[model samples]
Each structure stands twice: as structure tokens, then as C-alpha cells.
Target: MPPFLDREEIAPRQQNPKGYAQWLFTQVMLRVNVPRSMRDSFVLEGSELRVGEDRFDLRLFKRIFLVSIGKASVPMAEHAIQTLGDALPLTGVVVGLGTWAAPPGILSLRGDHPVPGRNSFVAAHELLQLMQTADEDTLVLYLISGGASAMAEAPLDASISSEDLSAFYRRLLHSGLAIGKTNVLRKHFSAIKGGRLALAAGAATRCTVLISDVPPGRLDIVGSGPSLADTSTVEEVRRILAETPLLAPVPEAMARFLEQMPETPKTLPEGRLPSTSLSLLSSDSLIEEAIQLVSTAGYRVIVDNTCDDWDYSDAAKYLVERAREESVASIPLCILSAGEVTVSIKGQAGLGGRNQQWALRVAQLIDGQSNFVAMSVGSDGIDGNSPAAGAVVDGSTWQRALRAGMNPQNALESFNAYPLFEALGDTVDPGPSGNNIRDLRVIFVNKQP
Candidate 1:
């Protein structure tokens, strides 16, 4: 999870907007799950120790292995070590962010993210070597999560550096394009991502178990489908570059890869036969659970939202007005809405991600009505450049800032929400709640406001 979702120290929904969205996000979702029913895909039993069916017996897959990289790799690896313990007979290297420790058999590598760094280059070579030497019996476990884009980068050639890749990736994040478009662009430019990882693991059949943070999940686009076949081509990348001028002058190696796009081959059986076994252990499974729990908590969830035709301003005004309407009826309503949103970033970069920005902007639109509160946050912990996940705003939020002789407008306009919330002492902090589903926001009309 990102830092933005951790702001509220208490239950926020019945009390404020941030709380409701956080509740809907952290309390109801399963960012990771490995049940026995899907055991063939290597059950992630309590986050460690994948129990595979007869399809993958220990004797067949105990050769030298390859553990691919990503954000969730650490915890997933930790759990795997716990499950296998000293009994497992596997020799492999875990290439990922260095902060995580791999048990005695695995070696951990520290890599950078939002962009590849020096360590990423070293890790890339190591992974390339591992993939080359791995035989058909080698069991490759790909640990994929958000931020794998940079953490495990492998440009096709030496012309592109980690700095270049990071700058490119940051531009994509700020582009407001959907994740699909972003990964499509990333796939063409990257050697390790875009199924290149899988192509390397082709010498051996690999099983990829993932916890998807991307909404409306497609196995191919998550972490740019590092271990999956891609139907997208270089010409498509050129088209995106043509349309989104910000991503001009494609790297030469990337252009070459695109021009030389390989033909899609037929699916073959396991045994490193151009095959990859994959599973989605978790996703947006928490929304309905949140609806059930919050609805029964004396708050009426308005379940009929379409989120259509409404700009952020329109949505904010409508929420406050609805709060006013409900207040008159003596009913407190929790307007829960979940989905992805677009941010058209222009000029200088802002300080917050969409969720924090959404909350801050809405704070400006909503009147400090005694009965209203609004907040938003990414289901993941981090938001944009700032450290807060999201925020909660009430009638008192603005006044408290005014009393402190500060300007809320400046904070919202400049995207300095972290400091703004800090001054008010109202940020929700739910450290690493163990799930991601894009972003979640909620407006709660309460009895006490």
C-alpha cells in the first residue's frame, strides 16, 4: 500500500469521507489470496509456501530457479520461505528491491522504482543470466505487483539508462492515460517487461502468481505483463507517441524492437514450452464487503451512482448538495463510489496523485456544512509525489486551517495536500493495509458532521 491510504487513525466512513473510502479499500479487499481450490496455480497458503498439484511435484521443479521482481515480491517471498523452510531443495536468486530479505536459499537485490537505477542494471544482467542457464525443469516463480515497471527494467540495449527509463516512466504516470495504454507503451520499450521475462523463462516452464492492483484486470497489462504473451506491437507504440506528443523520440532500440515485432506463436504445454502458468490471487474483492459492513453501520449507502458526465467540480457540488438534501430528511448518507479517474497534468508537476488531488479539490468545492465530510485516496498506499494516502474534510477542516492563518486554496492548487492535512492533524494513516484496487473515495454525511 502507498502512504496516502494510511492517514486516518480511526474509522473514517461514519465520521468523514477519507474514513469511508479507506474502510471500503483496506477493510474489504483481498490484494492477495491463495486458496486450495486454485491450488494447481500454486496456492499462496497464508502468503507463503505455494502448494502445487501433481502438475508441479517438488522432484520435478527443484533445480536452480529464478524469482522475478515486483513490489509484492518481498512479502510473497517471505511467506514462501516460511512454507518451504529448510525442507525445500531449490537453488535460486531473488532479484528485486533490496529492502526485502530472502531466506537462506535466496539472494535479495535492491532495485529502484518509478524508474530503474544502477542496481536495476546489475539485477537485470543477473536475471538474464539466470533465465539463460535455467533448464526445462527450473521452476521460475514470478512475483509481480505495482512498480515492477522500473524495479525490474531491462532495456533492449545500452543506450537507455535507468535515469532515462525513470523519466520516461514518470511521464507515463503523469500522462493520465489508462494503465493499459501506459503498459502498452512500456512493453515496447522494455526488454524485461512486456513478456520478455517470460520469453527468457521459456527455457523452463514458469508459474506466475500475482496480486493485481490494476482495475478490470487483464493478465497481460499488470506490471506490463512481464511474463505473458503480448498482442500489442511497435506500430501501436508509434501511434501513441504520435498522439501523446509528450512521449516523442522513441528510443532507437525500442523502435527497432517494435519494427522487429515477433509473430504470436501458438500456446504450448508446460516444460518451458513457451508456456507460463498464471493466477490472480486478489483484486477488487473488497468493495462489496465494504458495502455490506458500512451499510449496516447506520449509514445509507447510495448504491445507484453512475459517475457519468460529471467533472470533479460537478461531482463535488452534487455530493454537498446531496448531503444537504439528506440532512433535511434526517438521514445520514454515505455516498460510496469506486473506480479509476483521469488526471490531466499540465505545466509544473503537482504534489499529489489523483486520489489526494481529488480530495483536496473537492475540499475547495464543498461548503463547510456541519453535516458533510468528503475524502479520497488510492487503494495503494502512496499518492503522487506526496506521502499521505488521502484525506478527510469536514466543516471544521477549512476553519481549522483558517484559524492557523493558512490558505487551503494554495495547498489544493499547488498539490501540497500532505502539509495541509498535517497542519489540521486530520490525515488518515493506515500503514500498508495489504491491498490495491486503483483508488477509492467516499463522501459521508454524518449526524454530527
Candidate 2:
């Protein structure tokens, strides 16, 4: 939204690349920072709260507190406070990547992204203190979005140090395990995840407003479901770890830590208070919005398969082949896809994320062709460890890389696509759009000009 991309510089030769990229960026902006989803899901009237059909009377509680985490935390929390009219006896903390002005009585805590840090540790303690103060007569409202799992953390046991946790966290991220498995593991050791946060509220009435970035039907995994039920068990965590190829050898501390972890409840323990109100503000709806926008742009839109578990190379190859097959379209062909990909970064220290890697691979596959352009983007406006949201490349991209003194094959092999894309001026950076909904990709095969 803040001009992270030089639109004209990245446009393809014979296609309306600038306009399409702009529209996609607008869609990402709506999904991440805009409050339309929040407004539609949360309706406040006096002391009563309505989330879809569910309702809660906040007047029933003597004290009201808020806990917000993840990329969308600030915007969502601000919306809640504004809707609550700033006089609801609210006090709370928001932990997120970007800095934001906190409403009165709320403390804004800076949180690390993609990995938890000392700030996350401190924020976890503060959150515990806040929830520990709540009584049966109190109401705790939690606003959760993607990245909360890393943005806030506290070990359930004393065996693992913060440094150990950080190491393990990095390993899990690089392991190429799907997010659901990653979250299942995250909940096992953390004091605040997998409904532990809700348990800490004692008998307080709890409500949750969720902006889901997890796979569909898994709201319990969103923000690792701090206040919801966790259906995954420790066995699942161990199995996933054993099966997934980790980026580094498992640390001894992690092994010991996992062995010592108490068995996570596969369901709520008897008599535990579930969230009294839960609302989902965003999810696949963003994908649908993107589809409509692309179709409206006059390209013949083709909905591609969800690529959540696909390897970046495999997904890129498949989409490229399909785009090639559709090259005869009278109108331009736009292939759309949504879902995250896994990249096993086994010590490669790449400067790019999965989206860039995927696009880079596609660029290689279509190198000599002149009509195809492919892009993959993280909806949150940041991809992996790189500054770019993603990358876009046309058939000429490989040659462009060569002209810029970059070797595309070497970049892909080293898991270092970011620098190559950067040199070729193909990287797309949309600067922290404050939202997350997995990844979205678009492949355009122009009408054979």
C-alpha cells in the first residue's frame, strides 16, 4: 500500500502487468490492514457484543480486558476499542511486529516476527499477569491473527531455555512441515498456546475474535488457538518431527524438552470454560475476492489447485505446464492459486521465502518462452526471511538475470533467489501489509502475441 514496488519497472512486455499487480496489491491490503472483515464480524451495541449469531453481554462482567497478538493485532484491537467506545473499562496489551498507537489503558508491546525473541518472552509474562487478575466476574477478550504463535511464547516447563526455544523454533520453520504440524508442536511446550491462555483465565468469561490464516476448519490452530480447544496431541507432534526433514539436526535441549512435555489434551479437559464468543474475521474469503478481481480484469481466470503442501519446485512446475497448455486462449489466461508451500532450507541461508523460490523456479521452466509470467506472493506482504513480499518473473527473467550477472540455476540451487530477483528487479515488496492468509499466486499466459 505504501509503494513497495516500482510498478513500471516490473511490468511484462506485452501484458498489463502494472495494473494486475496493483489490483493484487489492493486485494492484499484489504485482507491484511483494512478493517472491513473485523467490522462485519464484530458488532458492538452498548454492553452487548454480537459476532454473527453468537452474542455476549459484556455488562455481566465486572472487569474487561483485551489480549491481542500477531500481525493484525493492532488494527483489530484498535477496531475493538473504537467499537467499545473507549469507556468499557478496558485494559490490555497488544504484541505485534509493527508499532502502533495504543488506545488509553492499553500497552503496545513490540514482538518479533518469524521467530520469538526476548520481547516475546516478556510479553508472555505480562499476558499471564493480565489474565491471572481476571476472576469469574471478569471478561477477557482475545484478538488473534496469524504470527501469534511466534509473537508470544512461554515455556510450560523449565528445561528449555529461551535460546533453546529459539533454536528449536528456527528448526521447525526450516523443516518444511505444514503449518498445522508446526502449530501442533508449538502448543506442546508453550504455556500460552493451545488453549493454555484460556485456561489461565480461571473462570473468567472469554471471547475471541480471530483473523484466521490457518487452513480451513482449523480455527483451533489459528494463533495456535490460545483460547480454543486443541485437538492435536503430543504423539502427533513427535511423529511430525520424526517424519519431516529438519534444516538442522535436532538439538539435545529440544529432544529433552519434547520428552519431558506433558501429554497435550486432545480435547478440552472436563469443565474447562470454552470461549463464550468466537468470531472469524478473515480467511479464504480473501482468495475469493482475488478471484473476482482477476476475472473482472478481463483475463480468463483459471482457478488452480491449492498448493499448501506442495513443494515449491513441484508446484511451480505444475503451474507452468498448465499455463503453457492454456497458451492458445483468445484472451489472456490468468491462473490463480492460494495456499502456502514448504521449503526445506537445509542450511542454505537463503535471502528469499517460499514464494520467491516458487516464482524463481517457474521463471526457469519458462525461460525461453515469451508469453508467460508467473508470480507468487505472501499475503502478509513479507515473504520468508526476505524483505520482498514475493517475486514475479517472465520468460525473459532468466536472460535478465544473466544480463545482470546473476545465475538463476545457482540462485535456486543455493536457496538464494532473493538476491537474483533483486538484481533483475523482479522482486515484489509491499512492505508489511499487516495481514496473513497464507500465499496467493498468479500465472499469466498471454494470448500468443
lDDT of 2 by residue, 70-177 (tens): 988887888888888744588999999977788678999988767899999999999999988878777788889899999999888876788888888988888888
Error of 1 at 281 (Å): 4.8
User: What lDDT tens digits, residue by residue, belong to model 1 across residues 1-449?
Assistant: 33433334446444455455455555543422222213344443432334343234445555636474665566656555554555446555565544665566677887676667777777777777777776677767676766676666777656666566767777776676767777888887677777776677666767676656565547777777777777676667777877886565555555555566643322423573334444444334435655776787778876423442234445566655665665534666777665555565655765666666666666666646666677666555566666666677766677777789988787766656677777786565554443344555677777762
Q: lDDT of all the models against the reference?
A: 0.61, 0.78
The TM-score values for the models, in the order shown, are 0.81, 0.92
Worst 10 residues of 2 by lDDT: 4-13
The model with the greatest TM-score is: 2
Candidate 2: deviation at residue 221, Å? 1.4
| TM-score computed on alpha carbons, candidate 2 | 0.92
